[model samples]
Target chain A: MTASTQMIEEGTALEVDGLVKRFGDLTAVDGVSLTVRAGECLGLLGPNGAGKSTLIRSMVGRVRQDSGRVTVMGKAAGSTEARMALGWVPQELSIYPRITCRENLGSFGRYYGLKGQTLKDAIAWCLHWAALEEKQDDVAKTLSGGMKRRLNMAAGMLHRPKVVLFDEPTVGVDPQSRNRIFEMIEALRDAGTAIVYTTHYMEEAERLCDRIAIIDHGKIIAEGTNEELVEKTFGRRSQVLARFDGETAAIEAWAGRHGGRVKGETAEFTIEQAGEIAPLLDDATKAGLELEDLTLRRPNLESVFLHLTGRELRD
Target chain B: MIALKRDRGALVLSFVLPLAFFSIFAVIFGRQGGGTPTVKLIVVDQDQSQASAALVKGLQSESSLVVMMKPEAKSKSAPAPADYTAATAEAAVKAGDAPVALIIPAGFGQHPIAFGPDAGGSTLELLNDQSDTIAPQIVVGLLQKAAITSMPSAMADEGMKYADKYVGGFTPAQKAKVDEELDALRKAEADGKTGAGSGDSGNGNSGNGSAGAGIVAVNVRAVVGENKKSPMISFYAAAIGVMFLMFTASGSAGALLDEAESGTLERVLSTRVTMTKLLAGKLVFNTGLAFVQLTAMFLWGWSAFKLDFFSHLPGFAVMGLCTAFAVAAFGMLLASACQTRAQLGALSTLVILIMSSVGGSMFPRFLMPESMQKAGLLTINAWAIDGFTKVFWRDLPVTDLWPQVAVLLGVGVVLFLIARRVARRWEFS
Candidate 1:
């Protein structure tokens, strides 16, 4: 898989190396290196104010970095060629509320030097892709929050760029809107448009991202496929917690039977399967130890992040 | 088009507020000023003669004043009219309200010829509170003429004595009549009743005057443009226009701040929108709106009065463009620096008021001190309105507007560069 991924360059969709950005004395994005390959969805996961927005902005040319390079389709970001080859759905819904969705799309397309027939066709394609054909003529301000988010997506795609970047796209939205956004992103990615997605939602990242980079405090702490991240933490094992209301010796006997060391007064241990948790709890009960409760935690991106950062994924 | 549609309310208000202000000015200063202006005059009649009475009558002709008959009384002790007081009136006039009062001293008619026509000692005392600046000036002219006309024949006779002194001779019979008059003057002088014996006290008997001496030569030519409409109109128009325009500009630029707050600017930026293109779009829209507003005001001025809009079209165009460009650039600059709509609103209000006030929007630069007028030239409103007046009132050619246009354009360019610099900083940081 690694050899195949390396062999298929297919014109690097988006690439950045050693990018550094600073605001006054504060370093926001420090020596971050990243890439989004063609036809792939790459998710950027981080806590609030962890430089996710700043990194995305730098990639799109909305921000100019102090050092390093960003390129879209082998061209520098903010250059005409790079901008033409890239689409952006910024974290904020930035359409003019009083203008119709069609007008907003038209204006955005025109900014990319598209006009007349080409512009019209682009608007039509965006509306269809976003499933907003019926709402094209409605003023953006009048649309529901979900529809507005969808229209925002359509606008970003109006110029038909090969690479698209969504910065916290599903943030501050309803569950339905978030799901719609995710579906739209998946559809775009499946159509072979490379996407760089940033989100604080670990679940969303795990579900949607082909590869993910976990960032904190202006640095990428880890980056890999979801399975790779999970393995890095769980190591072919599962976590089980058993509540105890008795002396430590009884829980220790159960831990011995499970082939795991008892770590906490709460009698926490790790096993390779859920069946191990029940047997350990029964043994503790038989030894006259009160087995108050039992729980088994599965290996996921959240756990991987917790192991890496020593903090929960969702703030 | 999108920008305009999004800011419909703001755009409408920008145009409406200026039109409303223009209408208010038209109604207030138009041919029907509603009523006569009141001017208070303190009458000091030392002569206590019929001639002085006529002068007093002329002073009372002005409608503004409730004439105080005392020589010198404290303004505080003497109550003003119930509708408005002298203090408030002065403040209002300074603030462009038309209230004024005059004080005529006892010797005003007594010594009409005390000072030469060109000398500084011309003593027709008019103590006005500067409430209504124009009123004092108009009443001063009227009183000067009335006082000259009301000078008693006795003073005229004394002026004739100086003429006779130059002429060098008199007949015996004329001398005899002068002697008879001098004896009557002596008798009246003894009784200290000069008012009762005016004719008898001719200059002869005192030997300090001559017969037929009072034939003073007076040359007079009517001055043009006097007693015309209020001179305040030009300054007033400029003041009202600039004030309204500043409000309009500030209100319109507030839309930019709104875009920033609502995240629309960010969205737009995300899509291939450069700061230059965005600013260009805003400038074009705002300039067109400013022109339309100016045209409406000129039309309203014409219909309301004979403002002669066609004659001043070229000048109007230049001034309008200069003003529009400067204001548009200022708006852009403000939007680039400000973080939110509320902050922009507060900042704009402060900026506009300062600019308008110092730029001769609230007061005429001509009425201001020389230093202030020199400083006023630096303000965008002063030059723009001055150009407008040159075109509208002075009937000058469009070429003359280049100076004003250049200053305004320079200001616009400077502001545009500042806005660009700030915008770039904002985006990058």
Candidate 2:
């Protein structure tokens, strides 16, 4: 079979090559490049205004880049074949609020040219996949916040596209609802569907995505598996966590002087050797600080993410 | 206050709508174009006599009446059109050429005045369109005035003949006095001081629409809409139907703004559908909705009002579909031009209300001054209402609806094209 006819969830499902999109003086997406493989979930991590949504929009063919190439399932971006193969769940709740979940799915499916029995079956399958079978007949707005998010996602993939881009699918959702979304993504990956997930929640990226890419100012600054990124950023190193009893300002000053960061009551520092803890304690004691408890742990995706991206993700 | 101040759309709608409506009404009623509309009266003089000729000249002299003997020539070099006969004059009234027609019989000069209240023989026939209530009354009142003031010799001779039949014969002295009075009247008429110059008496309707005339035996006939249960039923059906159709279409078209706000437009565009296809789909849906609305409105008109709707089906269908297409395209244009629901609501209300008021939906265009009537032609409401009036009121055939059809279809095409162009903003980011 030719590449399009194959429709197999193997190899490269989507690719963006040297994409550049400028809006007047601001470059929204600049020279962004990546490959999303089938049966794998790629997490996109970015702080506010970091061009994550723009890059995803460009990949979904909702945006035209000033200079770039984007291919979906071996077809050029914005082509009929590419549009048919790609699914985009927008950052906003884009589903029709006045319509039933099934109807919303049916409307989107029809846009993709599904019809009759085929459309009905696609809607049914989407309901099951979104874990919304029981609420299929309910209007989308009447659903819970989490249910609305799932319906939005379900409408995007109603046609069973080989590649799907989920942009902040779990935004404003509770923890329980977010876990449900994680399960949904996991199920899709198990079924060999290619996924590009975007979120500000670092733990979601760690839990759902097989690989993570961090974009900042319209460029991909980092990309790898969670462990790979942490190792690459700070190789063979560990983070030391200590809770201190002292004035908040003094502890923060001490943490900042030692090339460490204070998060709430705890001060954290990365060290290559355990012996470095002795000097850290010695400095804390000299500063008239008392350590309540301490723990040694490896640096995580959050640390690596902030180390490269600067501002807080939610900001 | 702050929100209203910041929302420019609402602000404009609030201040501009009332002012615009007021201005439209002022222009229509304030006599800015002219004080009173001149009545168009067709004159057919079968009587080739001095008295009938004088009467024609007299009616022509009135500033408030436009008396036409024949249709205008197509061009300056074209042959003069034939004068209207009794048959053609009546047909003109039926076809809405002139609201009232005066047909002087062949022997009207011999018996111009009827001293008796109900005297018969060689009477004048006044053909009228009942829909224009004021025109017929004005014609009737002025016709009698012309017969009395214009022909002094005919009135004298008729009075003598009636006296000779009823009373004893007139004396020589009486005869001599009457002859001297006739001479003086003839001299005045010869010097152009008689006829229309006798008086500028006809400057308004005769205060009543009913046909009541004196000094001449006259038969009044409503040549059009005489059989309908009520006048203005079919008129209001078309008039109000088209006005509401405009409002409904604009509201329906505003659905695009709603979808855009909700982000469904972007999401749908990301699918296999292109912008053109999306707009085309909306156009079709809006057109269908508008057509259905028009059908329902007319059907309601038929059931409630005693309008003769069944016989005019073909003409209604032609006008209805064309009007529907135009209004639907109009809605699309409004939607495409506006960026938000608030803007669409404000803009559509302002525009549709102004168009309706100016286009004769609010009142008869004939009641307005000539210039305002011409301006009314620029509105879709005017064209659609005119077409329906031809079908239901004038009973014109479907073939006669070509002008309205051509204009409405053309407007629809142009508006739809403009809407398609404006909708390109939503195609991509």
Candidate 3:
């Protein structure tokens, strides 16, 4: 490999340290730091106004940080070299509505210095990748919301940069298109392109991200793998929920010994391990508690986000 | 109430701007109904004689003429040389320094003013640029009135000179008879009576001489180029056409702000293209749009009013292109300065209405007060209208439009530079 290519491979594909951006008195992105390795997908999860967009913007050099630094592929952010290596998909639909899909892709591709046969090839590939080959000649305004969102992604990815950032790419898309977008992202990741995806959907983050960062109030309050975060926030405990057929004052007395609580005919028990669930059920049965339904719940990112931030993931 | 508060700028412009312009133009064109509008004339008196002085003073006293000339020096010992000459006066008119130049030739006061079909009538030459159709006519009419008003005195003066030369040698009795006959003729002419006096029998030979000497005529000659006559309808058509063209160009230029709001501008900025190049592309497109609009309007005028469109196509094209470029640059500057489309609309409307009102688009600048006429020179509309007047009214050659073209293109370049600086936010914001 060339020395520059080898050097890029040795460092993180994207790195941000102590990045702070303020608008007037509000710190939009407060001293946030993160890194994404090559071929790894880092999902940025946050509620509205959680500084996710600001952080993403700073990473792409769209907004200058008040402090600290952001670098892409070993180059400073906002530099031409860094910009040439970065791809961004903003939350809003940024395609030209009056132009055809093919023309929109071609125009954006040219902005990236793609021209001649290379530009045509990129446009053709993006049309097929976005599943818009048939509708390539139609004006973007006439497309459905899902189609436009897909096209928005396709436009950003035409350059095939080393680092790609998507800011809430599937906010208002249909389920089918959202799944397709997820698949497309997965393909990018498998192709060894580092990705930073931001979304409010926890399930999407849990399924797609290799590591997830939960941000709140302009700070990354928590960052880890899904299981690591769950264990760190809530310990290795599982909850067993039992609905009784009748009122069970007797079961409440037995379950209180095992760190469980009873409300009316339902009993909820927090156990240290999954093996403890059977013994608790045996005790409940011995206490003459007639159970109608029982379910075992494991801790997840949603609960971890709640446990760490004391708020829901989407709040 | 919410909508009103949201669009307060448009609200203010819709009501306040119209009322303001109306009050202004009403005061300007309203009082013009009672009296003839004055024409600015420059006079060069080559003949420094009594008759020439009297003619100049008489024209100066006329309400319809504002005479401008170099004043004589105050020192009687060392008088200042005359700075104004016939060539300079003619040049002044051609360069639009004044509407008309009235040159009194040498020896104009020596001969008797001729009123009838006399061959050697003293001619007062009026030189005009012909851009102004109405002003020249007014000047000509004022000259005619001045000549007619001075006729009786001129006839008496000639009659006295004739009596001194020919009748001086006559005998006292003969001279007394001739005097008695002249008094009777004067009384007869004044009493609405036309009959030869009874002394006609004795003074019949001198009667012919006295009668022939009493008539004086003045001829007024206009020096103007061919095809310089422009009808009032055609003038207004061109004026109103350019005024609305500015409005339309500004409106179209507002599309830049729309694109910004829609995120397309931001998307384009994210590309490798620099902001300056993008703005330049937009300027070119808007300028072309303005040019096409003006061309269509002129074509319609040609079909409707028989305006000389094809005859002066070269000059017209130059004027249209330069004016379009300036107007487009102006519109883009407004767009770049304003943050929103509504603000652009209101502010551009206010500016264009004021400029059009003061710049001879709605009313002739010649009819405005002198102060307003000077103020009109500060607007693009003034230069644009002046250029079109050269092509359509004066029928001037294409080369003559260079001054207007230079000013317009220069303004366009300057405004585009300012717009480029102001529009940097579109790339970074």
How do all models score by TM-score?
A: 0.68, 0.93, 0.81
The DockQ figures for the candidates are 0.35, 0.77, 0.43
What are the per-residue Cα lDDT tens digits for candidate 2 across B1-429? 999998988898889999998988888887634334678989999987777888888888777788999987889999999999988888888878888898888887777777665655357788888788877777777777777777777777777777877798779998788778877876776566764554465345353433334676667888899887879988888899899999898998898898899888988988999888888888788878888888888888888886787888999999999999999999999999999988898888889989999999998988777788899999999999999999999999999999999999999999999999999888777
Tens-place lDDT per residue, model 1, B175-215, is: 67766775565455344343322222111121111111112
Query: For this target, which candidate reaches the highest DockQ against the unseen true structure?
Result: 2
- Indicate whether candidate 1 or candidate 3 has the larger DockQ: 3
Could you give the CAPRI-style class of model 3?
Answer: acceptable
Prediction 2 TM-score vs. true: 0.93
Among all windows of 10 consecutive residues in model 1 chain B, the one with the lowest summed lDDT is: B207-216
Model 1: runs farther than 4 Å from truth?
Answer: A1-9, A23-26, A241-268, A273-292, B1-238
Chain B vs. true chain B: TM-score for each candidate? 0.52, 0.93, 0.74
> Which candidate leads in TM-score?
2
| Model 1 docking tier (incorrect/acceptable/medium/high) | acceptable
- How displaced is residue B57 in candidate 3, in Å? 1.4
Q: Candidate 3 on B1-429: residue-level lDDT in tens?
A: 788778967887978898979877876766666556667888888888655665676667676667888534667787775666888777666656677787777887776365344435466666765446566666655554454343334445456556666666666786687677756654543442532122111111211111112233322333444443445545665688779878987888888888788776766665565678778888899889989998888888888777778887888789999999999999889988888888898898898999899888988886787777888888888889888877776666889888889999999999999999998776542
Ranking by DockQ: 2, 3, 1
DockQ of 1: 0.35
Best by lDDT: 2
Tell me the tens digit of each residue's lDDT in model 1 across A1-315. 453244346546888889999988888999999888888999988887788888988888877799998888877888767788889887778888899999998887887778889998999998888888999899999999888888878878988888999887776789987887888888889889999988778889888999999888888888999998888767898877777888788778766876655645566566786666666666777888887777777768876776677566677
RMSD values, in order shown: 13.6, 2.8, 8.7
Model 3: fraction of the reference interface contacts it also forms: 0.41
**Per-residue lDDT for A37-129 in model 2, tens only?**
898899999888888887888887878789988899889888999999899999899988998988889899999999999999998898998
TM-score of 3: 0.81
